[model samples]
Target: MSKLIIGRYIPGDGPVYRMDPRGKLLATFIFIAIVFLANNWQTYAIACGFCLLAVIATKLPLKTFLQGIRPLVWLILFTALLQLVFTTGGHVYWHWGIFSITSFGLVNSIFIFLRFLMVILISTVLTLTTMPLEIAAGMESLLKPLKYLHVPVEQIALVMAIALRFVPTLMDQTVKIMNAQRTRGVDFNEGGLIQRAKAFVPIIVPLFIESLNVALDLSIAMEARGYQDDKPRSRYRSLHWSHYDLYNLGFFVLLTVLLIIFREH
Candidate 1:
């Protein structure tokens, strides 16, 4: 699995790590939308260059991003294959009974692959650089206007933060449970798909119980600490808008403009 660490955060000192999480979050979303603006090699190059630049800004090892992407390789490839098979037109290189490898399909598949890759890249950059608490705070602040519309922005943010924080914890617990079962002679990979799924039955039942107990314990602890959803709260670490955030905004806006200018008509 190469350790799926999508929601895992790495402690580091760098420009990306220092930038406001709110900006990073906003940029991640905006980038996802803007990535589709590229339709040709020229446009794709520009968009991909921006992604590479943003990645380089993180100052984290390339291996970290590679590990995060490795687990998704098959999914991305499957999507690309769908695009390659279903898309039609342009010069045909090879043709079969129901599938044809046309130049258009090939290019479109590559574009689809790159778009998916860039989106995951930006999201990984956000989660990797920002802490869970900071992400929650950023989300809450960004959604603050929703309070006027009666949305529980704080609770939503809190849930998201908790979910992110628990991803690694749950993964570790799953691993531990699997190892314990292995010690008891559970053969997970020794049989076919059905057999492998059956092997997971023991892991799933105990893991579910453990998860419930953990959640109950957390709720109890929060109750003891007097945490309330409706109460007004102040952060021990408040978020502040900075020149760096403005710079990030400008950088992405410039990229957006470039995409618009260069994209196909």
Candidate 2:
């Protein structure tokens, strides 16, 4: 179960790891927009280039990045298959009972599959480099203006931070529980869909109880520390937009403009 989580951070002093989490989040959104907004192969190619550059920037092993996408392989394939069977354009390449494949569908499927792969890869890279706490802080700072609309920005950010902070911990715990069951001759992977799901019941029930207990304890601890919604929060580490962030932002803006121009053409 621990191994199922792909976004675990690996410590490094690389340029990507040194970047402001806020910038990374913004750039990821820009990259996603570039990919999804694309209507042509050229734009997709450019987006792929940008994704490759991001992977290179991270300085992590290529294997690690590829591994991050493994869990998503089935989803990518499923989406591609749906597009291939449903998209109606160009000449039909193959036809069978209640199924047909066309040139347009083939191209669309490949593009969608690649786009999904790139999105996952980019997000995985972002999470692998940035710490969860930094991400949460950056998110809160970025969304601070929303408080003007009477939104509970602090509480939302705190919840996100806590959730992110516990993902790895919970994953580790799940793995331990699975291993303990396996040692008792339980086979999770050998069952049919319903049976496999049933196997999770034992694991999930324990996990849910433990999680509730932890949440209660955390709330009590926060109250004991005089945590209050009316109070302004300060951080030991602040989110700052530096020259590098500006440069990245400029590059993304140019890329977006180019994509728009290409789409018009």
* Runs off by more than 4 Å, candidate 1: 167-185
Question: How high is each candidate's TM-score?
Answer: 0.87, 0.85
Q: After superposition, how far is residue 244 of candidate 1 from its true place, in Å?
A: 1.4
Report every candidate's CA lDDT: 0.89, 0.84
Give the C-alpha miss distance for residue 10 in model 2, angstroms: 1.7
Alpha-carbon RMSD of each model: 2.5, 2.8
**lDDT tens digits by residue: candidate 1, 89-148:** 999998888898899999999999999999988899899999888988888998999999
lDDT against true structure, model 1: 0.89
How accurate locally is residue 188 in candidate 1, as Cα lDDT from 0 to 100? 91
Cα error, candidate 1, residue 106 (Å): 2.8
lDDT of 2 by residue, 145-174 (tens): 999999999899889988987887887888
The clash numbers for all candidates, in the given order, read 0, 0
